[model samples]
Target: MGDIEPGALVLRRAEPADRTALAGTDPIAAAGDPTRRASIRRWCEQGLALLAEDSRGPVGYGVLEYTFFEQGFLTLLTVVPGARRQGVATRLLTAVEAACTTPKLFTSTNVSNQPMQQLLLKSGWRPAGLVHGLDEGDPELFYLCPSENLSLSSTLRTFPDTVIGKESRI
Candidate 1:
């Protein structure tokens, strides 16, 4: 467990050992697709796994993986009970966004997950549309921001024009 803030929490990269912490949560594991066990393993192997920790261990975790078509994808994001409304998810997203220099980014959440939708919108990611049946019977909501607009390189830090599902050479 890490130190908790007075009214918030801290987010950091998760180690392989943190798997146990993640598996113990309901929303985190339950939100995972039934057939994605192997994909989860792959995400752990290659993607950036992050956790939000407070005085009570990990309360949230998000896995971000590289996509074959897009520059990157937000594979998963879950915040446990007692940690909501503290900006933990936002911090996790911020770290995820800061980790890559991709020209485009993508993430999908179940249509029922309104909090995540709000979080995505608040984080400067605009919704493209709903990706039907991508999450079992749930409609997956898509969000994206172009890398040029997402550059942290000081020079190109300004925003760029971005649209969902748009093709770009870079």
Candidate 2:
């Protein structure tokens, strides 16, 4: 684990006990149904839930959903309202990227969510294009990391050796 801002925040693997925090504390709840909950549990089981915490408790969480496309997707990520701008989301993004060495990762955000767009760019994800009516007329901005750039061996050499193959966790 690493420290950012010296005692202001901590990043770590999220545990099963964090389920409630994820459901109730999320800044955006995608679907309020059993399916979403089940998916979250599956991510936790796969070791894909990474969280950010502070003096109080979990302030941010990111869940990744793996696909056969050789590229992984960040299915969900939320940072509690008050924790915005503290780098919580960034930490989670970094951890997830380290684990999933898919040469490219993909995530889409509503065109109106400028902050999400900014965050994605800040995390090194390149904007690919816009998917119109992606969610019933809600255009989503897509991002990608090319296969040539995501070669597992290259990323492993750039990142800590501990993260090598962690993509299999998903």
Candidate 3:
């Protein structure tokens, strides 16, 4: 599929039946990795997966879990190469945020993944922290999307003084 019309995309909770199609949408998963496939299956089984489809079929999927600091955490957000840069990831992220049950939703990407970092910032996610050693030279950059119920002051207090300042986006 080429650039998809935003109106044509449908977002829904992923099911076991969607595992194959979902995996097909991600290059890493489509490459036939057992671990990635199993992880997708587990996300579906736990009702933590959301799928984005158009008339063509499954185009993207996202996984959100409340396993980080007892808050919502977006573990995966993948879109097929053909269907990217057309708001598919944004829609998935919005759905995940709406489905989140906690006061804050968190997600992280490798520092080198500038595209994802840009998307997160553009979509209203604030920089939370940076973690090193996970991938050697490529550090992980964390982001936070606090719910309406969460106050900015509380969120700022949660991070180090250096992470939050007058110039901070949060």
> TM-score winner among the candidates?
3
Over 65-149, each residue of candidate 3 has an lDDT whose tens digit, in order, gives: 9889898899989888888889988877777776676778899999999889999989878999999999999999999985552
| Winner on lDDT (1 vs 3) | 3
lDDT of 1 by residue, 105-144 (tens): 7888889999998988877788777878667888988888
Q: What TM-score do all the candidates reach, one by one?
A: 0.73, 0.74, 0.85
CA lDDT scores, all candidates in order = 0.64, 0.66, 0.79
Q: Which candidate is the best by lDDT?
A: 3
Better TM-score candidate (2, 3):
3
Q: After superposition, how far is residue 56 of candidate 2 from its true place, in Å?
A: 1.0
- Stretches > 4 Å off in candidate 2: 1-5, 27-33, 146-170
